[model samples]
Target: MALMIISSVVATPSGNKDISVAIEEMERANYFTFVMLINMVPPNLFQGNVTFLMPSDRSLSRTMVPAQNSVMDLLLRHSIPSPLLFDHLLHLPTNSMLPTSNPDLMLKVSNRGRRSLFLGNVKIVSPNICTHGYSVRCHGIDGVISIEKPGLASPITCPRVASAAAPLPLLAPPSPSPSPSSAPASDPPHGAAYETSGGVRPQMELALTTWMAFVWLLYSKAKLCV
Candidate 1:
């Protein structure tokens, strides 16, 4: 969808500026949430000088994350803490990562040309949502921006808190990790006779005894003849 740029509804630092053009621009681009966020925010809180980085409706719907994840945090990750337009953005090196309010700790930004601005790895389909304000530039991206992981798995336990009541310890920093060693190792059972102690049948024992008797008789006869 082609975004509509409206100018009457926008808020700015100097005075309230008409954002009817940016509004129309965003509407056409299908950035419904971005429009709604701006419209919903308390006018005074966002009334000061600032730039907004907005995502499209499609962008929000495409994430693999659960819905409870704060949409506001994700929005802030895309927005620069300061007001910066494309022309000003040019000074930054390409492939530079920017900081954001999200705990994820980082957001990626790369510019291919005046044509597009990428946020986190997503492509911006439409930028400069409102035509009236030079400070605010809106770009539509293919996906949502990234933030620092809210809670990550830890391989090691964190240090315990110390208190006036505590166990005594006689310890230095733990020694280096133990050297590798070899020993008998338990193996998966794959062989036959896992639990049996003897032959498959008792008949085999009698057969061996009969053969021994025949050999002894032949030996006695030979000795007597000699």
Candidate 2:
């Protein structure tokens, strides 16, 4: 329960000239406790294009204050609904994720360049400290922003759609050639099941010539009834 320093007066809204010149460039960069937590919220939550990410003031004097209804979810988890700057956050490339303004928090970056950037676990340490506000920007981190717990970050993977190769089991067409005098066989083990058994060997030789003409019409009607 420490952060309640107020006094820079920022009630904004004179048609919010970019959040009043980004709260006068975050009070000339002293970042007075993140400009008193952005004057305790409201001003259309810093209207439109944001990008604050403040923190410093010795990293909000060692954290733990946000209460008045969580100060607009602690300035929407230290803003960033777009107006980025520090060279547009140096083309965000390290695991890049960003999207804060609290929609379930995000900001993953970490770029590792300009004196070592970073985001989720803080570190910016005063980048473009609110570039003369063309929609408001800010920067200056080095602590505070730690909310990242969507199952402890780092898991975007998504590119595994190669599963369509299982249709090769239709080989059951070779059971009729067993009647050539009832049993002269043992040579059918070549390759690919005997090359697919010659496509059903002419329908198994027309079903063995109609089963030998119905067994010679029952042996010519038992030799003409004997």
Candidate 3:
């Protein structure tokens, strides 16, 4: 079936220039079906930053075109909320997930190289086709991206290893008490030398001096008698 293009102009408050430039770029790339799909959607949706993952005309011709009411959902699922260039997409590692404009949908990346980048099931055949627009960018894909269900396995799988319990801290042994002989001696208190029991050497010296004086007196009396 031939896809119809709406010739009627849709009024937009701003960002008309970027969208017009982007649509022109898509047309130049011969993505007429995608351009027609873009025209069917409201102009306000394309006014914000967005990246379109456009399926090629040959690929779209094989599948059925989306209905008028569901066109917005199809477009949103194929687009990213933020403007991402082909170079930016190459930075995403394999198995990384990108959130689509639809909150419930996610695009799984399989980036092997520049030529081998795949989003979901669709591989980007043409990179950076709509780079002329500031807020809009697009890349042509080989096929329509498949929507992943929320119940499926998560994009990243972390291994579940049992966490080992933390080890207890070691306590240091108490130091041994010093023996009396090994201990250092402190100085005696003042006036301790004058006490009777503590001053025995001083008392003996005083008695020896008094006995020598009495012996010298007895010798002088014996000399007088001779």
Q: Highest lDDT among the candidates is held by which one?
A: 3
lDDT of 1 by residue, 1-226 (tens): 1232234333213434534455666777677777776665445434334555676676666755333335454555665655565566656566566655443455555667766666556565655555466444555656665544322211222332333224333233223344335423453232122233432223344555665765565565555445
Query: How do the residues 97-123 of candidate 2 rate in per-residue lDDT, one tens digit apiece?
Result: 878877776777878788988877777
Ranking according to TM-score, highest score first: 3, 1, 2
What does each candidate score in C-alpha RMSD? 27.3, 22.7, 32.6
TM-score of every candidate relative to the true structure: 0.46, 0.25, 0.60
Better of 2 and 3 by TM-score: 3
Error of 3 at 190 (Å): 64
- For residue 128, model 2's alpha carbon misses the true position, in angstroms, by 16
lDDT of each: 0.52, 0.69, 0.74
RMSD of 1: 27.3
User: 1-226 in candidate 3: lDDT tens per residue?
Assistant: 1222232222232366787998899999999999988899887777847899999888777766558767788788889978899999999998778888888777778899998998888889999999887778889999877665442124443322222223223333233334456344663332344454536446555656765665565565555445
Error of 3 at 41 (Å): 1.4
Candidate 2 lDDT for residue 109: 83
Model 3: per-residue Cα lDDT at residue 167: 29
Q: What's model 1's lDDT at 95?
A: 57
